[model samples]
Target: MIPTTDDPIGDNPALIVIDPQQTTSESEEAMSSGAASIPGGRDAVMENINTVVEHARSADIPIIWGKELHRPDFADYGAEIESCEPEHGIVGTRAEQFDPILSIDEDDMEPAEYVIVKRRYNFFHRTDIEHILRTYDIDTVILVGFMTNICVHYTAHGAHEHDYAFRVAEQATAAPSQDLHETGLKCMRYLQPRGIQDITDITARLEEYDGNQLVKRVKESGQITPKTGPV
Candidate 1:
């Protein structure tokens, strides 16, 4: 179990990658159906994500990749289909899996232990993520991945309600539009001041934690900047 500490990251933290799959717009089906699509420019986002992943791995931090997958019959899909393309994330389809561009290497780490499947936007909703967190005694979670305004945003809420301090990799996530992405970051920052952080900052901190034998804890001064709004 991770030791309790005053530091925001605590003693043990996990990296939570949410829905790192190809956007509907990148697939052939989207061309035919004109379904909802994540905006382009995933290449840049994945580069930052891989950097964070590499550092987290170097620090021996537990990494959990969450992918959105639905039942073959789409029975698990709820009101989301009404808002999004119904065919997305269907079982036995490419959308249901992680994007090939991700840096997840099962040969280097146990695949089963590093991936979680979800049917909804919230990673914790009806998933074993809570159990995994409890097992690892994870006090903080670093969230990064697709649709900054949707899955990433909702998972931040899940982390809050589940009693886990969290951070969002600012440049490692994307949305359908720049405005929406910024809005998502603003919302998360409103939830936790200084929570929307750079991936490099997070990796540097993790490296410090690792080099310090993973036992040292930095006590905070209890200083926090009060936020007026979500900006």
Candidate 2:
């Protein structure tokens, strides 16, 4: 929930965007094939996520992107193929790369803006993501990504286990159906009751965060100077 006063999301936050790679082109191809798509288009959901990413950038928050990269032979996918993506897990294919809107180069992604490539749904599973968050001093993680019932859900649980606060960008994650999407959010809320949040509310708080950073910068510089935006 957003605060009536100051909000932690507006300051020193980390935006964890998971698997924003599936594009409209891929979705179209999936429809032609036997695979099913979650309710509400993935493209629309990613648009909301991009808005959050830009705001988080302005607020100087770390943006950690997770890309699900797996071997073509399905050696690293384990049971993931049996459940989902049996037809969808090939690498170097057209759908493998991130979409242009969420493209790394277009986003001006820095080396410091961490990108986690994982063979597992949970970013923390056998990954240094926990240590990475600690290095950045990321207190809370604002999550937005694909497969609400799968990757996003497990990642939220991972955040809980790691003792990091998390918020779900409800409009920013898509499942195969509206029911499953809501169910995923409900499950995440069960882990952290107040963690689920609307993208609109999150964006509003991010806008307010600009002034918060400005104030702090002035105090440190001892004079007014132009901000290069959040570091």
Candidate 3:
């Protein structure tokens, strides 16, 4: 459901952009035919992803970018080495870097933090994501990026297990196929009723984030003074 005026997705929140890396030419051959191509291609969701990023920036919300990088020696490959392409997301490779089309900047990692270096689909796995979230006092996370069925889906499970509420910006993510994309969203919604949401709703909630303090004040003291000016 879309967040309402009363049920705003308040409380401190962070944006976790999962594996927005460049796909390699050999990547398509590693997947089955059913999962070989994105419905409208990856660029279809780029606009939505950028829009969400813009809104998150304007709201002053912390933006954490997740990059999947595997060691050159393949020591971190584990079970994935058998099922996936070895060259995918290799360290020092273009695939390990964020897509230039993204709105990412050095400031996002200004203090040399918030960028999650992960080797697994789940960003919270063996990464500092949990500590980062706690450090920022973030209770909710807004997810956006590539492979909605893989990285994004597993990351949502990780967040749920870590006790952090999350919402997937439906239009801001894409999987290899439409069916898999919908399936991923369905599974997440089963975990959290309002987990799957539109980009519009996500942006709207972010724009009103400053009002969260007012909500907290009302709950703490049974009274609220109307503010006539900007929050």
Maximum-lDDT candidate: 3
- Give the clash total for candidate 1: 0
Better of 2 and 3 by lDDT: 3
Candidate number that wins on TM-score, 2 or 3 = 3
lDDT of 1: 0.70
TM-score of each candidate structure, all chains considered together = 0.78, 0.77, 0.79
- What would the per-residue lDDT of candidate 2 be over residues 89-190, giving only the tens digit for each residue? 357764466767774662554434677788888877987787767756666788988778778899988888887778887878877666677778889989
1-231, model 3: which lDDT tens digit per residue? 123222334367778888888766667444222331234456657667788877876676667888888887889988787764335778766776677788777454422125778998898898988776765577888888867778888998998888877888887887766688778888888888777777788899888777334334434453345454677
Residues 2-101, model 1: lDDT tens digits: 2344353556788898887765554544312111122336767777778888777666666789888888776888888786543667777667656777
Range of the 10 consecutive residues with the lowest summed lDDT in candidate 2: 30-39
Clashes of 3: 0
The whole-model lDDT of each prediction reads 0.70, 0.69, 0.71
Candidate 1 versus the native: TM-score?
A: 0.78
Candidates in order: C-alpha RMSD to true structure: 10.8, 6.6, 8.2
What is residue 206's positional error in candidate 3, in angstroms? Answer: 1.2
lDDT winner between candidates 1 and 3: 3
